[model samples]
Target: MEQPWDYLRHNDPAAAGILDALANDRTLEDIDRARILTAVDHAAHDLEIRQRLTAELTTLGSAAALHPSGLRTLPGTRFATHNMLAGQVRLGRVVPTANSALMRAGDFGIDHDVLRTSLMVIGPPGSGKTRSLAIPIVEHLALASLAGKASLVVIDPKGTDFAYDDWFDITIDPLNPTHGFSLFGGATNADTAADRLTAALLPPNVSDDKAYFKDASYNALYDCLAPYHAAYGAWPTVKELLALLRASQSVHDQVKAALKGTPGAKEWKEHLDNRVRQSQGSHDPAASLVERLARLDRPALRKIFDHQHRFEMRDINRPVRVRVAIPEADYPEASRVLARLVVSQFVQTASAPDTNRRIFKGLVIDEAGRYVDDYVARGVQKVRSNNAGIVLLTQTLADFPPDVRPTIFGSTGCKAVFGGVDPETADHFSRWFGDEWITQNTVSRGQTSSITYDDRTIFTRRSGHSEGHTQSVSSRRVERARWTPSDIITAVPPGHALMALATSDGNRVGPMLVNLRN
Candidate 1:
């Protein structure tokens, strides 16, 4: 007779070793062995199940690789064991400790479906927003990336936290001095490169009446780069691109002379001609863009955003993990500007049609409120359908522009609110959770003494008996916010969070409390 363990010994060594370890434990119960044997039998026939079982075995050890792919783990970070083939990692279980009826004690996480719609996490520093939510999500995607399932791009302004350089394929660091980021976003298309650069350079969240600034900046870059690429057969460097953008009539004449007799000379020349005409205006779009671009174009950053030896966002089409660390300490303003560039490029790249539609793509921006604009807010929903999603971490909604926060919040499918947040952020979550019907129960009890008399007829009314007892009970359904601002602000513990999730197919789980720790 061949036992399950024997079948395992003949086929998979990893599973057999894990089974031996499980069997040597004297504390194992009959039911535990039965489940283990059953799992072994299933795992023999299924490779993913086998991988999950081996990963599960690590739980008994001092350090566990929590990712089911068995590809990697984040040591010192708390994680749960779950089969992530469905694109789910159980970060924590739900806890029954909130006013909302939607919440219950159970396993909770955002699978690929919920993530495809996008995730937004709000919490203050030391509130586990990064350790518990953002990094774990990135780690989960990292494991998926290794298993040939998905791709991820993480842009961290703080830079040091996500030091998964060992696992990732490329690291784009402005301070690295060698490997760096592309100012032009490595876009093959001229308009795309121009749009990405312009988005990164343009001030975000402009009002409707002032949209000309945004439109003009986009047009100016495209006009220069499109003709320039057609003529030069390559992307312009910071110096060359800046000159074309900040062109005086002399510079414009040189640009025009270079493009003369080109294939699209007529139309390209006209486009450049329009840009030169606008360069003299009171509110020139190119002027504003050049000003912003030049702000970060310092001598210290020359090698970082260079055209050569730079990481391109276009490489994300394959399964890869890219980290672009912005040097906030030295280049404070450049950090913000480059952060916008990374996000703008990410959104643009993710939104483009991919040949491998099934491979999921993710973008994680720690402290995203500073750089994410109305463009990302507006385009995320469209990005969701393109098999990509973004994970945003913010201390408060206040960090973002007032005009853009609502749209940003509204666009994401998953919103996780952690403790220690400000009243305004809590208040927004409270209202955003909206109203739910709750039964209100009331009970009244009273005693009327003999001295009591009716108010309607004081003199004529008879006095009450020695004592009269009255009791009443009533219950009615009342509408109220599922969770109040006070609850969102004070009630949630440090390690726990309140999350609402919506699946890609439209199934929704209203805001529920979840414990982020193991």
Candidate 2:
């Protein structure tokens, strides 16, 4: 007949204090409550005390509930509300139960701080991977931006997925010169510009032979840009860079004669001579590099990067939404180049020393596999402390090359896998979520016959026979994955996904189902 709080007060006064705090404080944040509950859970060794604490905690919010495995449970709406109230950016809601036919409010959600380590959302086309996950998160971030709590930068390579034109303050279209945005605005020196340009031109995995040529091309490009920086004190336009790459002798002589006493003029002249000599050879080391850079010579790309627009790295510190829309189908080659440029620029901006960690800055790349490289992966690893987050949406794990896939996967702290994923990718998630003990039931059947003659009866009457059957059933625990690879393929429905989130305490909460809020 005694109350749970009374028992806590009599036995464990510390847990009783936590309960008293929860009951008295009307404005206690969910995060603080979670921290208090975690402390209580650790302090209470007795099973009854823990159960009482969990019961009391659940009344605070759905997120207060704990899984049987002792991990805290967060429902979707609660997760979103917790983050929004706490000023953290929302990713999506979490559905605690898996393979459910219906969804409800108060589901768990992922936040920006959790995603500062990076996030990977994998599902096939038409599987609601974008609609249910990426878009929703982007919308939430945009809302946060509107409230002056955060900023957003979305790289839409396909250009069709993001429909919130009204939400973004700056919309950059590489195909439209009128909406121009500079990729080199963040480059402080010639060397940084060269590195950014090199990453934009080269893919993630370049052949050994191509790597040598890339280095040569980088040096040539650096020299060409060094003069422009010395004279103008700013990065050169795409048109200027292209002109230098394909410069004639007279133009070269003019640039050299004009900058004879510059700091890097001597080195630049030597590199230029080497490039000129190499150009005459049958096997030009910079031939492939030249061809890749030539893609930027198109009227659309040339105009886009010709002049710097208003969007810059410092804009992330303010409340702004920068949407980069590149249509891949219309300009396949140019799209790849532009996508790489935008992501690389973000990495450079995030890496700068003056970046503001107090404001939340996010970069969302839909169909990221088309553009992700080692630079982006390394950025993901380093951006956590800078108060920046990245969300990469890809159709499949196979979209990333073999060598860089592990780096991308390893850098990500959370992963949401939706339906229609292949067996191999599903198996990867299964292993990532790890194993659990499952109850296995075994049943056996047998038949037995016994013939007993009445001892008092004579031998002539001892012809009676009887037949009997027996059945036995038993249950035991076996270790197995909570969700098998096939379970993902067959059980997960559209608009639903299995999310495995890494908690702040370094615990993985769920590979549980999450219902996307429409």
Candidate 3:
């Protein structure tokens, strides 16, 4: 019935023929004006369609759908079953794309390549940022599991986001309530525990001012490591890491003295006791400690067992990435530190001769705006080229320190912004992308002189554009670009987003609505 696709194959002779073909179909005349206008608007505005048409279509070649392979790498959220059209957009289903999958309701054929530039989904609390990101984490891990690869490293601030309890043949471990000969103490047999402790205690953020953390706080470091040793039952499991820390802490007494302090010693002892109490409520201190450590370390311990490789040993099949989620309440600083450490260490580990093959490790830090703003900015600026991607999530502009927003956006290769009603955040973001679009119009009326005046309908002149997030990157810089009055009024519920890609050839790909979950 003279559809958009039909225009490709007809211009003059064929156009008349197509018209004739549709002439017999009376129903074809009933097509809605609104739908036809929408199509025309899309053809005019959507950059992806424009590029494809320019590149592939000639006088002879038309009517064919644009292939998805042409999509250049851009950060986005993907759904399992592509939601090509609206599916009862509900608050519960509305969320951001957590990891790196971008899906639209219909089949646009955008290539689902392994994401390069990491994603940062910013919104606000209850904006569904975490859940949106978590789905991708679980799905990506599942894909890795299927491929017989370990591809995810989750450093959860809450520790319960992605439950791998029975899913991956992996273990879940929390560092807490452990006691006895500490790894931070440098006991020869406790060397392994010391190493694990070192790995655990290595702060994610390191400054020149606090560079001597290794030597300045040995006992505090030990207390931090205590949770790990307690979790593993012995320090030997992480011996090599201990050796590295030993070198760093060679002259440190802060750790030793801190451990020896009366209160410190008592707290340490009681922590050990709590481990035991967690198990079966034991009377014996050591026994109680053992049980408690078991409970806390069980997950991490189980993960170790599943790998079929010792901590210090190497395995070709071992997953290079691992995600650790610890509640902010348990060890807030540690969560951020662990995130930083893991990224830095993985990059370092990838270059090390023996571990170099395990080079492609990544870390996804959710709600990062609350904790590691500066580190995230620096990490995004430097890490991607090293084959290490860091995906950070935050729900609001206020959630992050205000001063770093420009740097954060500048350093990030991929930027994703979800829903926020706040004009401060949304409007600030608009400057980068464009603006939160609002339609404004002035309709003139014709008047007739009667007893009063008769109202006459004049045309409504439309002005302004739609608002959505857009990403721009060149050889020299990166920024979040927005579009003003980008398009018409399209109602997008949660879990949905309009994305735009600025590729090399002066083409702006979209501001397409993409769905990440179902």
Question: Is candidate 2 or 3 superior in lDDT?
Answer: 2
- Writing each residue's lDDT as its tens digit, candidate 2 over 1-518 gives 34335556765566566577665687864444544544353435667656665565556532343322232222234223335445554445556443222344455666766767677999998888777677767776765564445678999876768746465777877656556766564667888888887877866667887777778778777767777677557666666666677656775676778667788678767766766777777776666667888787777777677655646655687667778888677788888888888888777777677876655688999889888988788788777778787899998898987787888999888899988899989988888878776455544444422222221211222224434556555566767677789988878877878887774346666666866653
lDDT of each: 0.75, 0.69, 0.40
List CA RMSD, all candidates.
Answer: 8.8, 13.6, 19.6
For residues 131-215, write the lDDT of model 3, one tens digit per residue: 7554554444333322222244555666667554323332223353121112222232333333433443444345677555433
Q: Which one wins on TM-score? A: 1
Better of 1 and 2 by lDDT: 1
Please give the TM-score that candidate 3 achieves against the real structure: 0.45
Q: Could you give me the TM-score of model 1 versus the true structure?
A: 0.78
TM-scores for all candidates: the values are 0.78, 0.74, 0.45
Model 1: per-residue Cα lDDT over 173-246, one tens digit each: 76675567777766887877888887788777678987887888888889888888887788877777787777
Measure candidate 3: CA RMSD.
19.6
Sort order, TM-score high to low: 1, 2, 3
**Collision count for each candidate, in order:** 0, 9, 51
Question: Residue 426 error for model 3, in Å?
Answer: 1.4
